[model samples]
Target: MERLVQTIVQKRLLPLVLVALVFIAAKIIFALITIVAADEAYYWVWGENLALSYFDHPPLNAWLIGLTSIFFDNNVFAMRLPTFLTFAGTLYVYWLFACRLFPKAPERAFLLTTIGFLASPTLFAWTSIVYNDHLLIFLSLAATYAFADYFSAYSTDERTSTKPLYAGALLLGLAALSKYNAAFLGVSIAALVIAHPRLRTLLLRPHIFVAGLLCVLMLTPVLLWNIQHDFASFELHLVDRYDRPLFTSFKADTFIRYLASTFIYFGPVLMIPLVAIFFRQRDLDQFGNMTIWIARLMIAFTFVTFTALSTRGAVHWYWGAIAYALMLPFLPILLKNMWLYGVHIVLGLTFVVYATVNYSYAPVELLLGGQSSEVARVYGWPEAGELAVQLERKHGPIYLATTGYPTAAQLAHTLDRTDIYDLDPRPSHFSFVERKAIAPGADAVILHDQFGNLEGTAARFERFSKIETFVYTAHGVDINKFEFYLGEGFISDGDQ
Candidate 1:
């Protein structure tokens, strides 16, 4: 087995091709078995609604989901096919960029980097879901690649064509359409142009401004939608989301949380060497290649910005995934010892096993005494959907609702009904999607999760029927408990 592994790693193309195929196959298998989470179901509903833009995000993911639905059913596997494709595309881009940055590195070093990325537990487990991040990461990486290729070519050959620059700009537009975070990509590009003397002269070229215009043109729909809806999306992302004043509350715990998340996202194997390299070099230019310098800037800017945000408030762990992903090219630095390579191979395989088990079995729920929101989101929804159907049948076309957007959206997808109302006052994409509001004194059924809003939901109705508690169990362990109530009469808030 050792000899066979060595032979595969030594081969020019075998390791990359073999690992990629296996990784893709695993994604397929995982997507097939894993149930859809609330956010995914919410996005799936966006596919059903077919909107220009949404309250929470741009329309690109909703558009992709709509396209996926045309070819396949609304099941988890079908909806997530686009994400799988994008993940593969991301890997391909990383391969090209890594090879370009490390021309002196051996084939084995490149292969090791590929294995490290595919086996990162965070990405391996998380990327299977259909999210705007998948599209954002892929397009942003592709755009970065195009810009890097253009710069590298232009530096060597003055007569290099501007096709790559244009392509990069077009992709950056798509990336922006994917998620709001792509603004960071634009910042990186602007910074790269300003810092690099050779590329600075391109400011005189007319094509650069044309490319920028083309990118801005793609955002017309987003701008139009925001105009139609009072720019709520921008307000939500920019102002409403940040409750705390920036840099006012710089907590050590939050900063540590962000740092730890960055480490885990890179995976244990690569994170160690990556930190060592950073500490040893302590300068971006030490990476030597201009292409690498761009990625390093991305890593520095993303981590530093998020680290500050983390000090202010809780930041999502995966927000820095793009930065961590860009560290793939640097993985070749770990190839100094054959023993390190062997250890990396073992660790990579181990991560794959860990992800497969974690996704399928969900041992974390057991460890946490069945209190994982991640587990709860995926399970109990189908049962809740069925209960909603039966309740509506008994109640005779009454309104269905839940305390939160996630539950409401999951119920909508499960029952194939878009009229489900979220009783919570908190705004979500459902706020924009048109549905018949429940009139005063109308009958309605509300579903509440384990998080519990029984009294709050009861206040919205004149009176409540007997509440039924339903617990969903998997493998002899209870996953989540939900309360189903048949309300006597619905009372809409003044705003509704």
Candidate 2:
């Protein structure tokens, strides 16, 4: 028993334990406050419904969040728990990949995994939210790990492992169902197999057949969902891709900015070492050719895709996420370099302090629009609920209005009302109205402060004798005000 314990400790259990501690501590600190953003609330609603897909994302994250909330109840901690789990799971998987690849430098692999986890802003931020991105990230890393294992066997030995290849294919299929971005993993794997001489034998192996079968099996549900829904998922993704020329004058500038931001967001300390590892192929070759191929494929794909998409809105996070797992191999080497290690420590401390300061009472007033006393009061759902209740009492059937689905969902959830409407002027159900027509007699209007041309709407409401406003805050941040107006046409009891 004593020997087993020592064996576990010596085999990098300590690092794994430390990773868990960091994950739990970060989550607990963040969950002490109310939900920090609208996206968090929107995803929570997805969990409540437990659907196969949402208007914006796939169902994996919603399912995870729903499962977590079942145990903890629908509060901040419950909503954010899945994110914490994803972070922990991601670290563990990365460590596993490192161990398999760099057996000689296990400590280096462990350190790199830790640094990569801390440096990724998208990973950090999404981990705190109940969103598809978190779940997608987990599956993506898992798929990469499985692929590494499958291909590694070919280089080391003449025989191939059918299990790992099949597992990887199944995971890849599940990942594709989770999010469309996962298609890249398939492309990366195929490219690696075709390019590497030793791995070409995989084409003749039964594992290929098994992988194909597994992918089809795992993807069956998503395919059915798409078929039933007129392939709305595919259409949504394609429509989102803005049509732009391949090369533009600003391409170089935009790509450079994205590259720089990736370094900053991932933490300069960790990024420096990651770059060093890429240049030192000898250090990386110790792992396996597939590991190196996966890393190179991710980087190459991201740059090419981002370059093409830059002419449209440059969304860096999506590309950055694909490269996350591949970057883990170099983290330890970066830390071993004294200069990079010092920078990383400083950056890590800065992030903790910044996060803490955001929750401090001194900043609460300013952060929550200067009127709210309690951070929870400002950030919580009560204010919105109260406004909804009051409006319902006066108006026969109150209808809520918002520019976005998240805001609409927030009001609907808090007020215990589903008649809530979106007033974005596009085709939608609920009560549809122009910005200038919001008045008490026409029910209530919920408008975000960021909305332009409020003067017209306010003037129309002022014409009515009944006009009231309520303020709401989320996590001590005042999101917007709810304006209720009773127009001239409003009748007393006898008028009916």
Candidate 3:
């Protein structure tokens, strides 16, 4: 630990403390103010049943949120608290990895890497929200560190411990469970093992085999869930998200949109040059480490896969964000020129702009135009829930039903009712819950509007007793108009 204290005191301690404080402060502010986002709301409902896996994502994020719900109110903060803490862990792992990779000015190097992560528009912005990306980032960092240690060993006698190596495999499994993107880590692991002669010795060691077994064990839940659900989640990720099937979904217009979003999200000026630097130094063998090799594989995998998918539709920029930070330690070798600090400022400003758009309206709407309404989804959830409560007093514990999963989730959190669910036509997680809760002649209060598909929801009800539209407003602005349908005599299978 010759370098550990210097890195900790000079680079890690004060900034990390500030990071913690700011993180906590932001958590408090956002948690208290922002309503649940549509995806968050969707995952929030996933916590209600505590399944092995969800319709869209793996179960880790939902499990974390579900655990936190026991300790805090079922609000944004409670659901997102785990994400914030997980980011702190990622920051630490980044520092540790940097310290090992850059021995000369490990402190400064670590600080720069930390800034790289802290200034990421997608990573930083996501820490305040409950996204599976949050969990995957931390786990990805840890697994990256372990792989670097194992492969970058100074000698055969200095090989990495068996425990940490095995732990990396386990973490990767958990990461895959967090989001399917972690599967790309397999590319990194394979490249490391196959590229290096020493690492291939793992073929003889039972340690790697045990780790592989553990990884597959971790996937048991997702596999079982998919089997039960007609492999719906697997098919969704593989076929729907990744499989483009030649020229069908391919479009240059979509590819251009992907480039723009990726550039903006990764930092227009900051990341482009830095990525150049990393690849340049990597080419020259200036900073030869297994960590770089690991990150290189990851970046290549995500870039190639996402770029290919971009031909189909707009790409998700954050797909590479996790691997992006892992490679930042190599930037110092390439970035000795002036204006480096200026680039840092630019990255920070970019983060601020993204935060403003994500949380506020007027400015973002002006810039993003039609897409500005992304912020509107968070509105009216709590208010809609409140209104439902007041109406429940008159309706006498009426069943909660909403046209969209977003409304249903927010309402479920508000009413503390798992009975609250979406009424979409296709069988969803909501379909399973809503069916058991419904009884013949039972009164169901439906919050419906133009936003989501209500498809065949009306036919499930016999007749409507009361129908009215209410404008949901907040902060002196109207968010949306919702038509509340008090439908009595629900027609369940028992009626048939």
Candidate 4:
């Protein structure tokens, strides 16, 4: 026993194994306690109704959730298992990449990278939530590792084999299927290929063309879906999301917010090393140069591209998690200062603790004008679904409706009903949820809020009878308010 323990300690395998186990445990616990956010509920609905693609994101997240539902019965924690598993996969891929990047001290590299992942608020929290980014992050990193392996193997032996390239291409394609942002990986690869003469030769190879074809084949689902839908998804992302003119409004302010959020979400301690790596770049040894270059380029390209986009509209803080993750291999560069390194770990762990305990406590009223608060999204949803069920029981199968996708989705999941209509102009996955509008002149129950357009919602019905108001409260603070109305006649859009 002593010999086994000593061998493990000497190999530094104990810490790595402990960290992985601890991370998995923490994620499982957190997912169990974490309230299902609106986007998560929305995606769960997608899983309930399997499809080729969705309006906001591709079908991978939904597919994972759907598969998990088969086993876990759509429990919140079970629904989140896919994200946790993918994040774990992401960590292992990072370990492989770090080992390749710093072969001299692979164990230490992996240990520090795992710690860095836990320290980042976004990365840590993302593991507990089901989102498309989790899949994207895992597949993108896997693709990155495959390319690094290919570069190292090809450069060392000048082998013309195409297996690694094909693997990388397939992973990249899957990453793209997870989220549109995976395009950054392709750009980073192109930049690396263009900058490295040896890699640039890949462009002329027939195998490279074959790899490209593989990526295109992987993306065929998204393309075919878009074509069938008249590219509504493209318009939603490229045009609808950017409501403001580029460079014409609050450019500096938005850019500053983006940078500040980047620092916070990435963890301030990790940012110090990230910025240091950004400015103090140098060529790694021949075998690792391509890997390092791709990392640097991905970091630069993602942040810089989003920085520019932030000028036009809000760029979410979590969007930069992947960029911060790419900084793992360079973390050893900071180990020269043990005190700072220690502080980095301390700060990161502290943030993780703080976020785990208090991330869902935001108290806000349900409003329709702009972004709703975390409390508004999480709280009162179950009660609203329950209320809808009671109303349906009382009134004999009334259509349940709401004014927004978030409410519609959360309530739908709680009630296990897909017929809830979002009676608003905004486009959502509901458009493809395979449900017809409540028949004209049919009775329906509308969940109304004070701050929402009650007038417009009321206008959709010929008459409404007010029901009791439902309030979700925590610690003497009301988190959300819902006013229920039983409408006598539902009016479809064409009726007016």
lDDT of 1 by residue, 137-193 (tens): 788888888888887777677678989989999999998898887887778878887
Q: Please provide, for model 4 over 1-496, each residue's C-alpha lDDT reduced to its tens digit, 9 standing for 90 to 100.
A: 8986786689867865676566557766667776788788889888988888888988888898889888877577788888768876987887786676678777777777777777666887776688888888888888887887787777667665668889999999999899988888788887887778777777776776788789888988889889999998988888787758766776677678888988877777776776676564554666466666777888888888788788887788777666666667677764456566566656766665555554355432322234355545577677777877898788877777876677777777887777787765457888776443568898877776643456766777888788768887666666678887887787777986
Cα lDDT tens digits, model 3, 291-328, are 67777778878888888888876567877776776666
Q: What is residue 221's positional error in candidate 2, in angstroms?
A: 3.6
On the 0 to 100 scale, the lDDT of residue 230 in model 1 is 97
Q: How close is candidate 3 to the true structure, as a TM-score?
A: 0.85
RMSD of 4: 3.5
Who is ahead in lDDT, 1 or 4?
4
**Model 2 C-alpha lDDT versus the unseen true structure:** 0.60
Q: Show where candidate 1 strays beyond 4 Å.
A: 1-24, 102-110, 251-254, 273-288, 334-351, 362-364, 367-370, 435-437, 451-456
Ranking by TM-score: 4, 1, 3, 2
Index of the highest-lDDT prediction: 4
> What is the Cα-based lDDT of residue 248 in candidate 3?
76
Question: Between the candidate structures 1 and 4, which one is better when assessed by TM-score?
Answer: 4
Please identify which of the two predictions, 3 or 4, would achieve the higher lDDT against the true structure: 4
Predicted structure 2: clash tally: 11
Residue 52's lDDT within candidate 2 is 62
Q: How do all the candidates rank in terms of lDDT, highest first?
A: 4, 1, 3, 2
In candidate 1, position 207 carries an lDDT of 72
Model 2 quality (TM-score): 0.78
How do the predictions measure up, each by TM-score? 0.88, 0.78, 0.85, 0.90
Please, what are the lDDT tens digits per residue for candidate 2 over residues 417-474? Answer: 4455444432221221232223335645444433323343333332433357666544
lDDT of 3: 0.69
